[model samples]
Target: MSGELLLVGSIPLDTPEDVFRTFGEPLGKYLFAMPDGEVGPRRHWISRVHYQVLAAHPELEVVQRPAPDENGVERQQPRNAADAWWFKVRDGIDRVRFGDPGWRLGYARDAVNSYFVFRTMKEKGVLPSHLRFQVSIPMVNSVLPPRIFPNRKDIDKVRPGYEAATRAEIAKIVEKIPASELAIQWDCSTELQDAYGAIAGYPLEGAIERNLIEVRNLSPHVPREVALGYHFCFGTLGGWPRFAPDDLGQAVKLANAFVAASGRPVDWIHIPVLDRSDDLFYAPLRELQPQGARVYLGAVHNMPRFEKRLATARKYLPDFGLGAYCGFGREPTSELPNILNDHLRAAQIAAL
Candidate 1:
């Protein structure tokens, strides 16, 4: 069977409608569904969501610290310095408490708006009839405490409120949007951290099993009727992977772990294949047993070696869809069309 196309959330576009109109065909032709392209300021995804959450609760205070480089070198810079906003988070145990958190949480409202746009585009013939609206969410474990709280005690104190608020936000979405047209993807960049045994204070002894439990807990909330999927990520900054894998072994193992634990039918699972990936990088996929969940490999990139990468990927596991390593929101706006074009080209090559 030919592989379908999957968009791992954001597309750098002016609006959701534009994303549908511009790439809908190349997408509709090969994709099973379409995301709203995470248009507007939300192109920053987690950061934007964090701002919204902080804005609603005046109790929380934005705390800043020196920015740490990939090498752990602390750089003294302006709070608003390049990529410095990611490290700022509201820190206060009392303020972190969610008192009957409501619609003000942001994510549900965004998903609802995106779904309306999707429905409109579908009615106007921009999106295909069968296209389900994709709602991508960064897991609370990956977002809160980790990004916001550096102190382990602070993480323990704050995580409950943040998690409750997140669930409330999702509950709001489920209340509004029809389950049949919704697909919830829990983006897992921290899973890579778990795989590498690098999650600081978090014990890696049972990290894989712990990650599986998180997925299982979140998956059940989606309702068996709705589509639930996992995107095993390696972090992304400026459209580039944060960590290059030595092999897909860790990702493959986690994918299988999730499949075995998630009880509900996972409509799909996306795995990233970086620019430098070769057969060795993909060989571990031979152990990937998704049971029956569709696999979408993040094998698309802006390179002439597209066919070569796809061919190497096929050698280990031939049936899978196409996607970028992560969202293209951080990339130049001008690169959007070219990225779509690359998807089309990669899709063609995969068919051969």
Candidate 2:
């Protein structure tokens, strides 16, 4: 409930250069710069080490990866974006199977996502008994199923099994956590950015409304008292475009419109507050009250300096939280800390 807090994307698993040197050739060139994300002994150990460092902060909380598949879908547990897109194509196909007509597999996949995260946290010893356990589902940007299954058209259309699959997943995760400790966050990568316009199977408004519907749908499935948050922003990976929603003001307006339409209450709307060049929307942002919507404007960047970055946050003033800007500052490691401090400062200044 306090504003003086630290929020971060997942820590990168350390994949040393030497480890990649053994792989040899052109492949070796790729190894030196990859992020050692959650996977394997080294990453697990890195989390442990960082956990200890973060332990003393009192205000810091680390979002860690869930356990590996018991079914063995992952190979070596890649560290970082070294292979983030490694399964992009395959995943598309996998979801398509149940995606057609009745969303036969949508709910199933959603359930698996929760279970996998719960189990992964269990294995890593990262699921702190007294911590805020945040698990992000790739709703708009990444996890959405294909637009169609040409041959059939019964239930595969809307939201896979509609909200049934999502609710089931929500229920399962809540059951795993104690009533007092339950927290779930919807990672809405594909909300209202403008780029979604270019890649259209669903209209921009339609796409957004549907996703919000999913969020509202999932809410009742979880405990009434548990905290729910929505994270949104423009994103990119490996220098390639990932997604593009509209500007901050546009997003704010759209959100207000969406909320008005849905009539649901979301505890937090976590957004990229600082670092964006567009400053056209705060008036609009300010116009919309946080009566039911508490805006966590992301101010953090991947940079390390505190004062300079925190100043950036104050400059934005009640606008954003520094987070996942261009997908967590994908190019540099030093930027993360700076970005994070900016976010914390926003929370501090925003009284949120």
Candidate 3:
């Protein structure tokens, strides 16, 4: 992991190359992730993407029901529930059928556009030729269907169609972008939830194995030449973890499972380190040894004395690179420079 700095997808900027320019060569020289700045709200990042896909299908319906509230009374829908739409299969159709859902989905289109942007930057000497364009796609089971289908049975019924559509999306990206120039990252938020038993619908028995099966199935489509990685995250909103992990043990176990089941050469793995800057959280890293993939600890943040956080992480996992706990897309645009500076400062410290 020497001379490496990882961007954990998305930056609070206007364009992709702006991420490189803001950080300048010192930070970008090692590694760069195409900023998903246009992704509107942070919590709704995948929700918005799901909305786009659900809207195009005539058989699916997006209806608003009462918003769940702490007290029984319905309150105004939360922002995530407000703009984000859910899916419903048409009545009389016993099963949902997908015919070329990839054409209607925009995951490949976005990745392809970002690839072109990276190529332009590299050709103009704005980015190093070694810099790879990382495309982060949410795992199919991670976000959409659970929101739309409350019952596990319903989710199971439609899961295959949705997964196939996502596989198709990956196939499209692999077909269009040169495998060498691209790196595909599977974002595993909900899978983490399932691992911790934080989310319902997933059966208690063999939940982790079932989740790994999804990764094993979806990851191989990237082709052996293309770089592949996994981002095991707890949900993030407004620059904070939705559910703080007691420890990273579950994430560590999950990473080990993914690497074992992936059956492909995983280039890297990103694990979130919450607001805590203590040895207890980093302790699990000692046991986590992903055979070939380099590990990046999401130990960087905007908190005061955050460098100590990086120091603590280095103390436990000395060879790992640094990244934010999650993407900074929902953070204030004015904070972008400071966040970028934090990364630069940490990189400098690590290089020492």
Q: Which number leads on lDDT?
A: 1
lDDT value, residue 242 of candidate 3: 63
lDDT string for model 2 (185-243, tens) is 55554454532453445555565554556555555565756666555655443243344
Off by over 4 Å in 2: 5-8, 14-131, 145-158, 194-207, 240-246, 257-264, 302-352
Report model 2's TM-score to 2 decimal places.
Answer: 0.54
Tens-digit lDDT track of model 1 for 1-352: 2237788888888888888888775578677667788787667666665555653455555565446877988543323323433333344334366765546556787789888888998898877788778888887667663645434455555566767777777788888889888888888887766776766677867878867656666667778777888887777644356667688888898888888888788889999887754778889989999888899998888568777788788889977888888888777888876887788777777777
Question: What are the runs in model 1 whose C-alpha is more than 4 Å off?
Answer: 1-3, 55-59, 65-95, 99-102, 145-147, 200-203
Model 3, 102-163: lDDT tens digits are: 55457777777767777887788877767777778788777563655544455565667778
What overall lDDT goes with each candidate model?
0.73, 0.40, 0.71
Kindly give the number of clashing pairs for every candidate.
0, 36, 0
Q: How accurate is candidate 3 locally (lDDT)?
A: 0.71
Better of 1 and 2 by TM-score: 1
Query: How does candidate 1 score on lDDT?
Result: 0.73
